[model samples]
Target: MLIGTPTEFGAALERRRRELSLTQDDVASAIGVNRRVIGELERGKGSVRIEIALAVAQAVGLDVDLSART
Candidate 1:
């Protein structure tokens, strides 16, 4: 798995979202935001706040595991 910056994380998130057949608008509603928010995130914009990111993750059915990886 990749780590470090928004590119890796954002790419993974976008891929998963697409795999699930979800549009930016769908995810935005589930996460309580506008479609533009998801678009910005998919574009790998790191200006997003962590809380919003977490909400997006939740909306996408992705769990945030904070355990250290080996």
Candidate 2:
């Protein structure tokens, strides 16, 4: 999906996690972050660090591809 904002990314992450049967804690443990962090990320908190967000995305089996706008 073409995620245009942090909110969009978070929604996608949440959906994928549910699809994979993973709890927020499960994703947090897998990425070595606090469960609260996962919660914040899922809520699309703009303050979330890019590295952590990317890590969470990977943990949930999401690949982020950046391309120039056409």
Candidate 3:
């Protein structure tokens, strides 16, 4: 899926986690974050730090591609 917005990216992360049988807590533990942060991420909270966001994405095996928005 094409992730165009934070909400869309959050949904994709949720789907990937589910597919991998990982709970929010599990992901948080792996990424050195609290479960609430994971919850916020799943809810598409825009205030999340980029470093944390990138770490979360990497933890879930997501490869982000940034390019011209067109």
Candidate 2, residue 26: CA error in Å?
Answer: 0.3
Clashes of 2: 0
Question: Candidate 1, residue 45: CA error in Å?
Answer: 0.7
The estimated TM-scores of all candidates read 0.85, 0.96, 0.92
Q: Model 1, 59: alpha-carbon shift in Å?
A: 1.3
Q: In candidate 3, what are the lDDT values of residues 1-70, reduced to their tens digit?
A: 6887788888999999999999999999999999999988888999989888889999999988888878
The global C-alpha lDDT for each of the candidates, from Candidate 1 onward, is: 0.81, 0.93, 0.90
Which residue ranges in model 3 land beyond 4 Å of their true spot?
A: none
**Per-residue alpha-carbon lDDT of candidate 1 for residues 1-70, written as tens digits (9 for 90 to 100):** 6457786677777888998999988898887888888888877899987888778877787787777769
Candidate 2 segments exceeding 4 Å error: none
Output the lDDT of residue 21, model 3.
97
Ranking by TM-score: 2, 3, 1
Instruction: Report RMSD for candidate 1.
Output: 1.5
